[model samples]
Target: MKIIIILGIFLTSIANAGEHQIPTAPQKYLDMQNPIVKMDEQLLKITSRLYKRKCSKCHGKKGDGKGYHAENIEIKPAAFSIPDYMLNRKDGQLFWIMMNGSDDTEMVSVGPGTDIGLSEQQMWELITYLRKEFTK
Candidate 1:
């Protein structure tokens, strides 16, 4: 039984090794930053709940990408806890991703124009929360 558990853990790591790559966002998005300041506690709360509502189902509550539906999906949710990954990705890039889902994966867009999607400001708020809370 111990061997089975150990094997399972090893296989899981192997399964995720080089599973996917973060695509390059356009130059326009790469240079952008969150316009809102980090000290905005009120807005952060709102965005936190929004993250829970829209993203936590896949990205996990703590931004670890181990949510309830994580195992059942093909595209792995990004592990935002990794500062290296999150730090390099600009706010605009992340915001654009939230607005327009990944082209090569199952990251469906959650921004405006969709029937049930986030508005521009709401998307920005989400990014703010991610940067302030998770990426630190």
Candidate 2:
């Protein structure tokens, strides 16, 4: 009986994983806008390299969330390439996630003081790259 109950709970968690992993952005972040107005080729090149180094391990090269590490991770990375996925999320939401990663998953804070330490401008640039390259 206990085993069955545990299995039920575990299965329920897996079924609802998506709902659990996405952290809510504070109103401040939610209200914020992307400062980057345009993405030049030079900026794209820089952010692409940054993405490859920091994000591709889990989010995948094509932003499909099927990177080599994705299989072993308990919670899957966000699939940015999914149709309208990037469109629905606010710029602030995306920025907040990168700045303060979800606590329930492997995504970590990549902004300011984190070990991966990305500047605000760099993070915004990455968001620009995501919108341009991954949005379907």
Candidate 3:
């Protein structure tokens, strides 16, 4: 009986975990794709560093959305490793979200004039890193 109860709890937690969903981006960005065809190995390394610097705080080091600041934030961060949901999203959509940030949510625009802004190229790099490292 004890083992049964523990198993049920574990299954419940797993079910609840995958329920967190990132809202969809606007239509314009929904069809966007990563335009960088010549992704270099060095750029991939730099992209990892960028995610650690800019995204890991709330998205977690593994992109699991359970980072240190996750508990305190109103909107939960996205778990990039979620295959089913993330795979359905276009790379361009991710780029736009990273660029403009989600409104009424903790996701802030990491482009320019913001606390975590990145250059356009850098944004693309970050997106590339995210897709490569996570979302398998």
Q: Report how far residue 36 has shifted in candidate 3, in Å.
A: 1.8
When 1 and 2 are scored with TM-score, the better candidate is 2
Tell me, by TM-score, which candidate is best: 2
lDDT per model vs. reference: 0.79, 0.91, 0.79
What does candidate 2's lDDT look like per residue over 23-133, in tens digits?
779889889989997988888898999999999989999999999999998889999999999998888998999988888689999999999999999998999899899
lDDT of 3 at 55: 85
Task: List candidate 2 stretches off by more than 4 Å.
Answer: 15-21
Q: How close is candidate 1 to the true structure, as a TM-score?
A: 0.79
Q: Write the per-residue lDDT of candidate 3 for residues 18-75, one digit (tens) a residue.
A: 6645667788787766667556888888788888887898999898888899999866
lDDT of 1: 0.79
Q: What TM-score does candidate 2 reach?
A: 0.90
Deviation in angstroms for 23 in model 2? 1.9
Error of 2 at 15 (Å): 4.2
**Can you tell me which runs of candidate 3 are displaced by over 4 Å?**
1-21
Q: lDDT ranking from best to worst?
A: 2, 3, 1
Clashes of each: 0, 0, 3
Clashes of 3: 3
